[model samples]
Target: MARPAVTLDNYDDVYRYYLDHRQNLLSARIAYAALSARFRPRVHYADGARERLQALLASGTRLIVVANHLTDRDQYTLAATAWQTPLRSVIGRTRVLAKDELFTDPRLRRAIDLMGSIPVFRSQNHGLRAVADAGRRMMDVSAQRLQRGDVLAIFPEGTCNDGDPRRIQRLNTGVGHIAVKARKLGAPPALLALGIAYGPDPSVRGSADVYVGDPVLELPTTPMDITRAVAEQLQAAVDDVRAVR
Candidate 1:
């Protein structure tokens, strides 16, 4: 059966589709290869972080991967760097939360789909009142996917940082909500923070430094508390990348 085409009129259905869908392995490999060739980001892991990540994945534990957003090209750089890490083991099994606008172009949409991206309708683009229900549905779908053992990658800052790339912006609470919900659903995903920093002149093809922090196996009880803890850890990751760069 043909999968239903994703349309604005069927927002709920769209989320449901991605909840269980994994990217095709061949497509994921080709896409990452292209990104790696173009970006060639330098990747760094905190002491024991790489080994911990390998262990967590080996144990079949799902991860809520959060990163600090810098330039529009940060995603490409992160993807390239990730390909150089243990993350390559789960390329087709990871779900990246991306702004919905990226899905408008048919040609780019196919590539984004191959990267296993999930569309996120932000309140800034659609207005808070307008995107409220869609936001809830997106979170619910994300939580369900986590419970199903899919890796969830998110930029909790929600948008690119226009100011100092070294300092992480305030993160939205949506990530915390998803984590809490996923725990309640019996998944209890581990948290992984990825920090990215570009050179003085940042661009789509510029080389970057990426840091992978140690994973957090236990989460705070409440959403606000969880967000706070994630913020602290992500900032530390960002600092690590900057110090090494």
Candidate 2:
């Protein structure tokens, strides 16, 4: 009845899987980093999160950077923001929770695999039970990674929405569930709330900011209240960052 608590050893197979595909991961990390630099993405952040995150990283805080999934540009935005710290958003360095669709394509698959993205299946019009099951699966992965002190990033909104950062799309409650599960385990990594959007001039290169807000809610959020709490806190981080204009 203990749910067979997730552990780093439980993820040894995944690590082996990654090791077998190491070259592809290396290639992807290089390409994405090159693309980021070639485009010269700019950042305009206001929160102490930049420093706080660096400190957390240095202090061994496993960070779960929740970003706003926007255009392809959002990835670059994260790269630039990450540059401010010792940790760069190099694909192979951390795990990303991405949609299952991205894993199916061949050409794109290699790159995504290299980017350290774990595919997550999201069924449209599925019942909440199915959704919750899928979320727990993801949590197993997240929990395993956190147990090893690896950073994980996910887009809680579940899709790209290139709109006002303050006016975000509805977020699926899965991320909240993961946070809750992690907290319950008492060793879950820090799920720092981050808001990434088109700086001010996203159309042009090097002209926007990736705003990161305060940690809205610490991990181990009340299990009963977690699903809603993660969404509300993450949304608040976005709205609060956007309001700084």
Candidate 3:
């Protein structure tokens, strides 16, 4: 499979085209159903979190959902729950923030694109200046999508926590930058924190539980502030689920 050519000059257009052309409600629904049937995961939530999420859904408010990066199946778990919950209305319109390498595989790329995924190239592999430039462009695209009333799901930890599922790793400020820039675009998306954990029952196919936190409506002024705020909120939420587990 020939991967899509991505250059800084055309990044925004390419991403918008991918998102516009790939999102499919029917496919998302089917994928959700298939994953749910296969995993039979049990979803949990923080008090009043569901009602808040539902309200946001009803109002059609744009959102940036930040969550822990657990197993490869975490995306499927969230997708299944979203369809089953009030978020069902926004399922087709939500764009997941994913690493660029995930798009290299034809099969994985197809599945995620159908689920409305936007790619982020890791400029850290090149140099600090490159990282800064790439990060800005990525956030610009994210802001554009949010301003257009699209939902975004990102793992602020930037990668899976191989050390411990309950403990959130250090988060980068990319998630914060995206939110701040989106606000500048007049979107000011609501931030929702999520925590996902897999159950221990071997008899059951990895029962996963998702805990939702209240939406962070007040976005901080700086990227560092946003990063710290999200890190604290997500950590608390994940710990909440872990406490019950």
**Winner by lDDT:** 1
Give the alpha-carbon lDDT of every model: 0.87, 0.59, 0.77
Per-residue lDDT value at 54 in model 3: 87
Model 2 over residues 1-245: C-alpha lDDT tens digits? 11111223233443335322333555655666676676664444445766766677777666677777767666556655555544564345577776655655677766666566665656563445555555566676675666566677777777778566566677776666666556556655566656554555667776554556655435545654654555666676666556653
Ranking of models by lDDT: 1, 3, 2
Which runs in model 2 stand beyond 4 Å of their true positions? 1-29, 89-91, 125-133, 162-165, 184-186, 199-203, 227-229, 240-245
On residues 161-227, what C-alpha lDDT tens digit does candidate 1 reach at each position? 9888778899999999999999999999899999898786777465588999999999998989999
TM-score of each: 0.95, 0.74, 0.88
| Top of the candidates by TM-score | 1
lDDT computed for candidate 3: 0.77
After aligning candidate 3 to the native by TM-score, how far in Å is the CA of 148 from where it should be?
A: 0.7
The parts of candidate 1 lying over 4 Å away from their true place are 1-9, 204-206
Pairs that collide in candidate 1 are: none
